[model samples]
Target chain A: MSEQLATVTGLYGLLAEFREPEQVVAAARAARSAGYRRLDAYSPQPVEGLAEAIGHRTSRVALLVLVGGVVGCLSGFALQYWTMGVAYPINVAGRPLNSWPAWVPVMFELTVLCGALAAVLGMLGLNGLPMPYHPLFHVRRFEAATRNRFFLCIEARDPLFDREATQSFLERQKPLEVYEVPW
Target chain B: MTPPDHVATQAAAHSSVQPPDAPPPVLEPGHTLSTVTDKISSIVLTAPPPRSWYFGLAISFALVMLLMWTITQLLWRGVGIWGINIPVGWGFDIVNFVWWIGIGHAGTLISAILLLLRQTWRTSINRFAEAMTLFAVACAGLYPLLHMGRPWFFYWLIPYPNTMGLWPQFRSPLVWDVFAVSTYASVSLLFWYVGLIPDLATLRDRSRHRLGRKVYGMLAMGWRGSALHWHRYETAYLLLAGLATPLVISVHTVVSFDFAVGQVPGWHTTIFPPYFVAGAIFSGFAMVVTLAVPLRAVYGLQDFITERHLDNMAKIMLATGWIVAYGYAMEAFLSWYSGSPPEEYVLVNRMFGPYRYQYWALLACNIAVPQLMWSRTVRRTGWMLFIVSILINVGMWQERYIIVVTSLHRDFLPSSWGMYHGTKWDWSMFAGTIGLFLALLFVFLRLLPMISIFEMRTLVEEEKHVHGGHSDTSDPRGPAP
Candidate 1:
């Protein structure tokens, strides 16, 4: 608990605000090249190159949704087969008990349902959302990151992070302002 | 620093590729990111509700109360209160069910299908259109539940373990409808909510009031516009759009199966699936235009929901309208060509039967009225399109009525055949659902950013690119030099 508390209260990052998305992307690339592995960028809208600059390229959401769809499809068909073919089977014109054609629509619906559920749940899980508290929220001006400003932050947890050195490096990118984000 | 003269020359050269009157700008003039945030957010966060809003809300609330009253009486009485009987077992309830569900198709088409196709104009209208889908589905859902008479036993539709050891018949189209409609509602709600998160975060940040900030903050779900979040967000959004695109085709096809799987002459045709899908989109676009015209005028949002958006939507309606017209022609031609007396008789009855006027009116409203859109002027004129949309809405409803009642009323045995006329209860229920739809819409406009703020910002970015400004030249995953 004490270790966790120490981590929580520790210095979070040094944040630099840039006037343009290009500057943020350039700064992120510079920070990555300078051996800072734990870094992030924020902008009013998606800046094309910022994700790659921060080295976040691939996501597992599609794979999760595909797995969900397959599961949903199998389960849906299985449930119908069990109910119709085994439990309380009423002979409807002596048709086959396991009517696969009859099972397609429900299976399709369930596939979509699970696929959609996976999309939302996987996205939230991957993004770590509903976290109302974060160290970055400590900076009042950071709110503008959702409006007009662009920001790049280098985390203190990075092996090469030194408060003074990181501050100087971000300053070299010619940002509008630099601030230490506190826990 | 960039030279002003050089920028102007470049901008001029770019504009030269398009016709003299390049499409009206997607967004209004003089909008910086800050101004965009301020203008849209202020509508929800700061501006007082206009008197017109209050007036409309009151009327809608009154109608909703009437709906509640009718529903209460319906529960107290029974399905006997409806006009459905004899050969015409389905009445206004089914017609309205199909109508409301059809109205929702345009939203999915606009938001999901258009997004996949990379149509940027969808950004302006997708948010509100998705909301309309949710509300329309809600209204559509009310019919089947209430039409069952014992609304409390509606859970019987679900595949749950019961002491009675019964399961929903898998082969029945009615059962398929339960899955289709419910899945549509769930997916649409999630898609709408997922799209709202970023804009909600914007609302969270811009709101000055503590209570407003807290409310929007909770809804925003701690979004900070991080690049990592956007990466996952874009992926999830694309996946959902892909998933929803199939649903836009499938859900209505399943709905159409409820009729096609039957043995009735008009309902049993193989063409029902594609025909129903086309009609759904046709009516759905009409409803969008119907709602958008009044909405843009009321809110003075002519800049955001511009003439071009309406024009584009009108063009879609025109195309889909032709498809619906083709369905009608094919229905007539196939009935005659099949040489099946019962099928031929149904078509002849539809034209010259007791409901002859309705058939003609349906064609006039659905087919003839939309022909006005061939003229660019009518499509661009908001009022003209709005009136046309109202006509199409009425026509679509009558089309459903003709398909359901006319066929059922004159089925094989003349002795069992009977006419269906809507009672006051029917009108009340229909009006009530409309009231519910409108009230929900008004609340959504009041509380949410009807247009996506972040997406409109992307449009601004593109506009800057056209003007030879800081172009977004880097790939989404590549580093800047």
Candidate 2:
């Protein structure tokens, strides 16, 4: 396997967003030009063209849910059928070996349960929750993000990241301030 | 290209035109609910509905009182008053009970699950749904106690140390049902109350009378809408949502056990839990549609409870309908394929036997009618959905009847293959429960805020992503007065 190299050293995408959409767009373009592929942007909310500006396309979450849901449904049906029909069949009044009809509701519920669980847990797991520490929390004004701010982060692990060049590049985009994230 | 600062520029432009001393609150940039919410505010948001609303309420209350009277008479007379003969021990009382319980599922699903999912559309309908849940469950819970004949000794259902040395059978599904339903009710109330806290606060601030203010204030839990308070409140709410979601699943599953755990061939199926849950949601959504369509028209929440919300719920109904249909198919296939005569007999009897009309009715309402929802226009239209929802509710009730009375009516004994017919008292009691359910809901509508104000406010903030725009070089200290 080829060893992966981080493009921009130390400095990654901070995505210093403003309330105005134009400001966010302009900064995104400037970061791209500053040779910081690892850079990200932030905003209080979604701007129409923000995804394009950040050079990303689509979320993988839905695919995960679909796969998980299908797997869940199949497994659920198999488990019930295996237990009730094959493993330990209790024949009261000479009922049949495979009572498939009674399994439908449980199968359906399990599918939904699994699908929902996958959607939630997969999201959290992929996002890596309970971090308890992030450099962004150190910023006082960052608290306002929960209220009325939008932001995007391009991790230092991104191929285009560079410490000094990324910082200089972000500075040119007219951001409020760029902070280095230590992960 | 200039990013369209439609709101910001408009605000700035409007500010220049306004008198210098005018308040900034008037010029806030957000697209307030004024247009969307205001169109139907006179109709939807208005409390006490109208004189006509009260007239309906009065009728319902009267009917409920009649039901209570009937109950008193039944209690005085004995279980003999309900015409449940040998084969059909369970009658309208149990059917109505399951029907009401089935109706209750939609409320919890709409309010808790949708809220957790951050579905914005839930805002318009959740309050009403929660009220329906509380009332429907109340109606459902009355049956088993009243069905017991001597209603006074209903506490025997609850496990307690008494003068009698005998303990309640923990192993029995009936005992589990008492815990299940009661726990469901308690947890649902807690979830409902927690969700209402912010709305109650909104009502507290908005109320005209001093007593109203004080009353709502107390219920509002001294909420000031502080960030810290909201944080804790939200954390608790998420936890409760997590708890209630499973409780909702478990309650109906446990209820199914009342039959499934029995030795009856048709009743003893592993599919009871999920099948029961789906049926519960199906009946519950049907009931919601039945009530909401009329209430939406009467209360004037057309825009808020928009066609979109209706369409979504209809889709859900359609989906659950298919699930139930599949359940029926699977049951039939198994009955024949398993080569079990009794199982085959139960399935055959349900379809072509004595109570074949009920089987067809269930199929028509639960399976066939909901197929109409696949059409966008049918689902979006109020009257069409209302009719369908009503039919579905009736069908669901019949489905329970088919499951309980029909199956029990023809036990393993070939000699006792007789049908169970519901007496007039049975029909009257069912009617009475409906009246009771509606009366409670009507009262709830007048008393509580039918919408969550705090949650709505959250949507505005959520619309704006925290990671939104670029501000690369502006110094933190730089500002303008």
Candidate 3:
């Protein structure tokens, strides 16, 4: 990775790599406690408390899905009512045109449908996905972040990210490699 | 950089989590993260598939061709080509539609319902089953569309403004079917693809070919497996499972409502919804077993999809099979208890009428045969479970046929009471959907990691354990090619 970077590039941050998930967890905790507010951990699998160590301990996806479901259900019912009862009402078997009982099935379906769409899209939107180019990709060993390696990166944007001091700080935490991430 | 052998922590991460008498690990004990990734991705990235894959794909594609031919002819000739008439308005079209959709339920149950139940073993097989669900729904959706004489006017089911100021009657279960089936398909796809993103990222990183990297990269949506992202991912995934639980139960309930609302004697029973749901799970688990047995063998993935998976699935099938059997008993009792001649006649007609053999065969397939699974030997053996699953599949199809035909074949007017038999087009259409299902499955297996790689990674106690050496440049595996 270092060999591939012959041209001068701006620094994005320092990336500390670890072989095991525990090491990355420990490093992320240490970095967070040391006042690095902007940092992220990458792992091959979900570590039980890794996100908490990096300061993200709560999620709003469930609430978003709830709201989406209610809205979807109401709109579904409205659509049925407007169409069947108001817009194109045709009497059948002398039955009332406002057949609310029959509307429950479509409403239930729409609620699940819209709420699920929110669940996926909201999560992805919050995570800033489809971001094809990131500074982490510049570091070749980072590819293993999807495989077996664990990584904790202290971004340059962090208030306390001092390059030399953070390098030494990560070294003390005992990682496999501490590499400079290029922008 | 530290040396290859620093501090190791060889046994620290694992070894203490398991009790002495716990069953075998869901994943076999020795797999590390690298090996799991290697084993799953290798199907697409390294090793070519076995010759049997080509053979299966060929047959499925040919079936797809048959389906296309039948659909073409049906479209040209309208619904009249099938044996459907006034008395038997629904034949193989509705039967296959119901059967295929019912078969889809097990996948969601496995992926979403089992996940909510905190069943850890679902980690291995849920991905492919969900794929099966989507494909089955796809197959189910085609029938109702083709059944429409003017297939192009299918959009009339949707509540949209058209030139004629026409709107679909929202009070109809058929319209509800439109929304339910479409929603099921969309949500199943979302769940499946959301689960796939991280693994797709793994493939994108590991793929050696440039085109593979580009294609997988685009599909991955640039997933980096960040901790924050994983948190939101898990959050969204759990919410989806929560939503899908009721949705899956509701899907079959609505399908049964399509029949239960009818004035037909056999179709109007109140037990239809729960009975239909139970029968759905029964057939769905059977289909899962049918597919999983060969898949586990062909991939040599005994480690991931272990014997316990088969055992648990067989147990579920047994339980659901009893529910189905109970539904059958209730149907009979209700007919006699109601004391209505039409209701009693529907029951007697199913038993001794023109379709008595079909009823008996359905009993043998769904009830009598699944009873064999009570033996430990049958549940444990792959071939035996496979055989039972195939039988159950056939039995469930027969169940639908009897329900659809026997009820409609006898009306209040004996003059209109006539038997229904599927014509060539109907038979071909049914067979073609099976081909369509298999063809989609074949494509899915080739393109994606059928087993969820990231989920499998989570199963291991210590993912960081390298097999023979460390990862990265210093590894003894010769610098990762």
Q: lDDT tens string, model 1, A118-175?
A: 9999999999999999999999999999898999999888878877888999999999
Scored by lDDT, model 3 comes in at: 0.89
Off by over 4 Å in 3: A1-9, A92-96, B1-24, B462-481
Candidate 2, lDDT over the whole model: 0.67
* Span of ten consecutive residues with least summed lDDT in model 2 chain B: B472-481
Which model, 2 or 3, shows the larger TM-score?
3
The superposed Cα distance between candidate 3 and the true structure at residue B141, in angstroms, equals 0.6
> How many clashing residue pairs appear in each of the predictions shown?
0, 52, 0
Question: Any runs in candidate 2 off by more than 4 Å, and if so which?
Answer: A1-183, B1-48, B461-481
Candidates ranked by DockQ = 1, 3, 2
* Residues B292-346, model 3: lDDT tens digits: 9999899888989987888889999999999999999999999999988999999
User: Arrange candidates by lDDT, highest first: which order?
Assistant: 1, 3, 2
> Which of the two candidates, 2 or 3, achieves a greater lDDT against the reference?
3
**Residue B345 displacement (Å), model 3:** 0.2
RMSD (Cα, Å) for all candidates, in order, is 4.9, 14.0, 7.1
